[model samples]
Target: MPSDLLAPALPTAQLPAHLVASSTRYVETGLRGAANTVRAYAGDWKRFTSWCALHRLESLPAPVEALAGFLTELADAGKKVATIQRHAAAIAKAHALAGHDSPTADKKVKVLLKGIAREKKTRIKQAAAFTLASFKRTIRSIDVSTPTGLRNRALLLLGFTGAFRRSELEALNIEDLAFDEEGLVVSLDKSKTNQLGQAEEKAIFYSPDPALCPIRSLQAWLRVLDRTEGCVFVSLRKHQHLTTRRMTTKYINLIVQQYLGAPYTAHSLRASFVTVSKLHGADDSKVMNQTKHKTSAMIRRYTRLDNVRQHNAAKELGL
Candidate 1:
């Protein structure tokens, strides 16, 4: 929750004790609880409150008609359907927090959202996959002589082969990585999906080409840094010493965007892993093991473009 949201509008003594406690605890908690989710929810709330302020409307315990007006405003502005949906969710969550009945379920609001969805024709935008050739070229281009380059190379390789999300990669520590003759093992204590902290392990075996091997890249980086514990990927300046401070998703995004194209973000590496593997006939189950995707539905979305006629089941039919 944003600090303003958490800050009591009125003194605690002015409101009921139960309301104060509920607003403090659950108002900012969001639909599904995660660090990233909570942060996004806070942003959504900020936008909603700002809109309300502009219209001279009370955001807390917002009325159903006013909520519908908000949706209409968003639709008129040509906001994406997904964005409008999130706005509704933020309003609902805010009402819930203030111990008031939410207007999200009202018939008018539902109709407004349905109309917006039909008009916007919004579909989820899958990150463009980094082609295998492109991936190889990107890796080759990295000047590993510099400390910064070495870290970027190791980060890119591990993130790609392991099919790790930006948060997962940033969360990794030296202790999370273990190497052997076969490959490397990374233990993730928590992830967006694995909220219970049930440890998950991802394996990245050696590639035939040492230059392309993620394991070798990581091993080389480890040798240079020579750290027993701390973040596996630390920020390094050009010719400057390494800092133990953990890296953020911004750095990861910056690295990919700079080396590859601006369209390719940090997620492109992970999506590319699934796409490249599936394109060559890797089984869905095996791919899920690396990607840690609980369902095959999302995996199919990532690899949809590769599932063409040549790779389709009908190709085997003697038609």
Candidate 2:
């Protein structure tokens, strides 16, 4: 076997070869997680290290006071509570990987985090939900005569009906789709909740209106795609040309915002599904069946029944 295939040289050259190999395997295991999550952690750690370098403080074995100070600086700079917590987690993970005790584990650091949250009074902003009527209206405005319109229509309809995370839509491939008499089934090999690559499926039925049907729209787009394999959604250039480059999650958000406009994100597709389903009297279990939500609580969270008149019992009550 080539030496290149072997683990990188470690200080354990003086020890047994098996022990060194074991250590290398363990290190690899430490790095394993959802790709986006791992990247976020790395980015957080880099930010912390740069801050430490500016302050001439040791980053690897960060002192509790130093960690607390860094978190306070973040809060002072208007970072969200979740962002600060994630940064603290990243710092703690880096210290643990380097065989140093994490300062984030200290009582003082914990108290500082609580204080920051209380002082900031911050709450994570949720994506705005669009109504089914609005979605249908916007989708109808797209000119399907152009390749861009066909792709966008299919993308939006399928994304909303599937209740897919932006990442799931981006990762979708042609082979993952299965169509039959009833409707369409999208087989996901992996997703945000199913990072273990377990096979999960979402069912989509045909809408009575062909123009509004996800299944019909997808089929029409597939016909234009003219190939049996590769990414289901790819970039379309000017003058009806298409590129094989898979769409990114960021581009997905832009596509959604382009049509829906203002405060709406790609996440709005998923949220709208939950909201619409709940309005139509679909129970949590039925919604979860389509959304693959691990719990009923998440289904409730995704619902946007903010209108006082919507789903209220006060109107039905006898005075």
Candidate 3:
């Protein structure tokens, strides 16, 4: 029996193992755009397929009413509105991949989602901005002498200054870093925004303070790694044996949580970069340059709280 555990979970019951492996790679790399996205979509799709299988319903050629029923069931089961919506999108994508129009486009499914949204009053809970004061406190708190401390410090500094997504930080390797007279340049050939694999260069300028400088921190961490290749952030074993294995992005979140407690995500570093920059009066273009945001809307989303306070018309009004 062919393993259904592989991604794409397509038919290959009688096929050779090599052929199945090749097909899975094609589906993962070609059919799917990014690894993280593929994983999320696959999981969502799996939920749908499982539900369908349990009910003895046709999954691939699923009826519009069946999708509506699925949403109803999910809502009844108290799933988050956002999660249900993501599953719906996954179903749509799956249908598209299979060369069929998604039933999610039907007015029945659309109306059901709108009703659920209205009832739930759901909102995406964003990670709290890791403020500058908090940044300073974290630096003072964390021991920077050890190899692990240096690595963590470097990760936090670069993650904030680069405004890097968790995946972007995890995907980084020592070779991706380049230094020059100016400062350091961290190259990201492909990001969540630029999945075409186009090389995008984000410059990290030298900070006045030696403690907060990303370049210096990175250099300190590199001295510990002492290798020309492999991931920049790796699992540290005894004797500083940095494994070639890459650290999961979730590690970023746990590190922050260790310092700040609950309600902070790995994205807090990136969000902090935007909020701090905005508070310092940096313009949209400068912020976007580092963040690599395609539109002003996304940058605005990250800086929304600061924008409201900084640009308040009530400040000019007389009492």
TM-scores vs. true structure, each candidate: 0.85, 0.89, 0.88
What lDDT does the true structure give each of the candidates? 0.81, 0.87, 0.83
Per-residue lDDT of 1-319 in model 1, one digit per residue for the tens? 5544443333568778888877555434433456876767778888877888898988877877778888888889888888889878877766655556789988888888888888788886667787788899989889988777778888898889999999998889989988888888999999888876898999999999888889988888988889898888888755568878788988878888888888888999889999889879898899999999988997988874643663667777889
Off by over 4 Å in 1: 3-32, 96-100, 306-310, 313-319
Angstrom error at residue 42, model 1 = 0.8
**Model 2 Cα shift for residue 239 (angstroms):** 2.1
| Residue ranges of candidate 2 with Cα displaced over 4 Å | 1-31, 96-101
- The model with the greatest lDDT is 2
Each prediction's RMSD to truth: 4.3, 4.2, 4.9
Q: Which candidate, 2 or 3, would have the higher TM-score against the true structure?
A: 2
Q: Which ten residues in a row have the lowest lDDT in candidate 2?
A: 1-10
Model 3 agreement with the true structure over 1-319: per-residue lDDT tens digits:
0123235655888878889978766664555557787778888888888888988887886898778878899999999988899889888878766646789999888999999989999886677886688788887677887888898888888888899999998999888999998999989989987887988988998888888888998999998888998789887789766676788988777987877678787898899899889878899899999999988889989874634565576877988
Q: What's the alpha carbon RMSD for model 3?
A: 4.9
Q: Which regions of candidate 3 fall more than 4 Å away from where they truly are? A: 1-31, 238-241, 304-311, 316-319
TM-score order of candidates, top first: 2, 3, 1
Q: Once all C-alphas are superposed, what RMSD does model 2 give against the true structure?
A: 4.2
Error of 3 at 231 (Å): 0.9
Error of 2 at 169 (Å): 0.7
lDDT of residue 154 for candidate 3: 89
Q: How many backbone clashes can be found in candidate 3?
A: 0
